[model samples]
Target: MDAGTELEDHFRRVYAGNVEAILAYAVRRVEQPEDAADVVAEVFLVAWRRSRELPPDDEVRLWLYGVARRVLANHHRGGVRRERLGERLRQRLTAVTGGDPAGEVPERLAVRAALARLPQPDREVLMLTAWEGLQPREVAEVLGVSSAVVRTRLSRARARLRELAGDELTEPGHVLDVMTVPAPEEGR
Candidate 1:
C-alpha cells in the first residue's frame, strides 16, 4: 500500500477505536450534548492532524483523552469570554440609552417575536447579518452555503419580517434599525 493509504488506515483504526470513549468522556464533562459533540470533533481533528505522531493503538486512546481535556478547557474559556462580552455590551447599551438594558423595549420585543415566528433558516440568516454584524459572505461561511444563497435568504427573511412587523420595519437599515438603541439626548 502507498504511504497515504497506510496513514489513512492508521487514522481510521485509531478513530474507530477511540471515538466512542472520547464522546462519552466529553458528554459527561460538557453541560450540553451539542458541546460534547463539538469537543469530540475537535479531539478527532487534532488526531487527524497529528496522525503520524500518534502512538501505537494501545496508547492512542489515552492520547485522545488528553486532547479532549484540552479541547474542553478551551471550550470553557470561550464560554466565559462570550459571557463577559455580553455583559459589557449590556453595560454599554445602558450607558448610552440611559435606560435599564435588561428591560426589553417594545420595538425590540416586537422584532424578537417576529424573528421567532420565522423559519429557523430564515431567522438564523437574518440574525447572522443584522445582529452578529456578519456580511452575507461571512454568514455563508458560518452556515456552509454559497453567498448567493445567504443573500437570497436574507432578502426573503426581511420581507417576511416586514409582513409580520408592519410599520415597525423601516427603510435604510431594516432589522438593524429596529434593533439599534437610540442614544440619550445631551441635555437629558
Candidate 2:
C-alpha cells in the first residue's frame, strides 16, 4: 500500500523482533530498572525515527546494540556529572557552615532533622534562602509567589523550625544560623 503503512509495518516488525534483546542489554548495564526501561524506550524511538536508515536483515540487531551502548554511556556520564556537582555543593556548604563535610556532624544532623520535619512549602522557602542563597524576592520569583508571601513563609518556617528543634537548634557556625536569623522589617 502506502509509504506510511509500509514504514509502520516495518517499524512494528523491527520492534517485535528486537525490543526484548535491547531491554536485556540495558538492564544488565544500568543500576536501576527504570533507567533500563528509559534506555529501551529511547533506543526504539531512535529506530522509529531512522527506520529508513536501518540495516537490512540481521544487521539491524547489531545496529540497535550500538545505539543502546551510546545511550548507556550518556546515562552514565549524566550520573557522574550529578555526583560531582553534589560533592562540590557539599564542600561549599561545609566551608560556609564551618562543619565537617562528612555526613555525620551532630549539628548537621539536627538541622536536617528539623528541616525534614517542616511542611514542604516552608522547607522549600528555607532551603532556597539558606542553601541556594536566594533573597525573599528571588525565591518568590522562583516559586511564582509574591515577595511578601516568601518573607511571611520564611518567618513562619523559621518559627516552626525553632518549635520543632527548640531554641538551641544549631550552633553559630551552622548555615541555618547565618541564613534563618530574623531580618529587619521593610520600610520602617
Candidate 3:
C-alpha cells in the first residue's frame, strides 16, 4: 500500500482501538480535558508522520503512549506559555459568563492527592486503567512490560489509593467521577 493508505489504516486501527485510553492518560497528566484531546491529537499526528517506523499492531498502542509521554514533556517545558494562555482564556470566560472559573470537585481533589502520593509506576498503572481505560494487556504494552506486571502494578496502585482515600474510595465510579467533572458550559 501507498504511505498515505498505510498511515490511514494505522490510524483507523489504533485510534478505534485505543483513543479513549490515550485520552484518559492525557487527562491524568494535563488536568484539562481539552488539553488532553490536543495531546492525543498530537500523538496520532506523530504516528502518522512516522508511520514507516511504527511497529506491528500489538506494539502500536504502546508506541503511541511513548509519543504521548514525549508530547507531555514538551508541554511541561513550555509551561509558561500554556499557563498564560489559560489564564487569559479564563479571564475572558469569567468576564463573559459572570462566573468563577471551574474548580475541581472535592472528590477529584482527594483523588488527585491520593494519586500524587503514589509512586510513579503505581500512578501510571492506575491512570492507564482508570483514566485511560486500558485493559491490563494494553497497559502492559504502554508500559513495555508483561501483562502480569501490569496487573501487579494496578493491584498495588488500587490498594494505595484505597489506603489514601480510606472508606470513600471504595465506591464504584467514585474516583472517576471525582476526576472528571462537567465543563462549565456543560453545566448550563
Candidate 4:
C-alpha cells in the first residue's frame, strides 16, 4: 500500500479501537457534551497528523489522554474561550437535543450559578470528581496535585456545592416559573 493508504488504514483502526474510551473520558470531563466531542475530535486530529510516530497500543490511549487534557485546558483558558465555546456548544447541543434544551435549562442554570459562586480550584475539584467521574488519584494526575490533596479538596467542594444548591434552588420561586407559559385569555 502507498504511504497515504497505509496511514489512513492505521488511523482508522486506531480510532475505532479507542474512540469510545476517549469519548467517555471527554464527556465526563466537560459540562457540555459538545465540548467533549470537540475534545475527542481534536485528540484524534492530532493523532492523525502524528500517526507515523505513534507509540504502541495503550500508549496511544495515553497519548490521546494527554492531548485531550491539553485541549480542555486550552478550551477553558480565558473569558474569550467561554464565549467561543459557549456559542458552539449551544449550537451543537441544540442540534443534538432537538432545540429543546428547555427540559434541563433550570437545572443547568442552578448548577452553573452554584459553580460560579465557587472558587476556581474548588470548582475544578468538584467538577473533576463529580462531573468527570475521576477518582481522587486520577484527579490528581489531571490536576497535578497529590491524591490526598484531591481527596481533601473534593470533600470540601462537594459540601460547598450541596450548600449552594440548597441555598439557590430550594425556595419556591427559585425555578420552574419561567418555563410556564401564560394561558390565552378566555375572552378578549
Candidate 4: segments with Cα more than 4 A from true spot = 78-188
TM-score, prediction 1: 0.55
- Put down candidate 3 lDDT per residue, 31-94, tens digits, no spaces: 5678888898999888877877888989888988899999999877788787887987776667
Better of 2 and 3 by lDDT: 2
By summed lDDT, which 10 consecutive residues of candidate 4 come out lowest? 179-188
TM-score, predicted candidate 2 vs. hidden true structure = 0.56
Clash-forming residue pairs, model 2: none
Q: Sorted by TM-score, highest first, which candidate order results? A: 2, 1, 4, 3
Flag the better candidate by lDDT, 1 or 4: 1
Model 1, poorest ten-residue lDDT window?
179-188
lDDT of each: 0.85, 0.83, 0.80, 0.76
Give Cα distance to truth, residue 180, candidate 1, Å: 6.9
Candidate 3 clash figure, as a count: 1
Ranking by lDDT: 1, 2, 3, 4
Candidate 2: tens digits of C-alpha lDDT, residues 82-155: 99989877666555556544654655667778889899999999999987778999999999999999999999
Q: Give the count of colliding residue pairs in each prediction.
A: 0, 0, 1, 0
On TM-score, the leading prediction is 2
TM-score of each: 0.55, 0.56, 0.42, 0.42
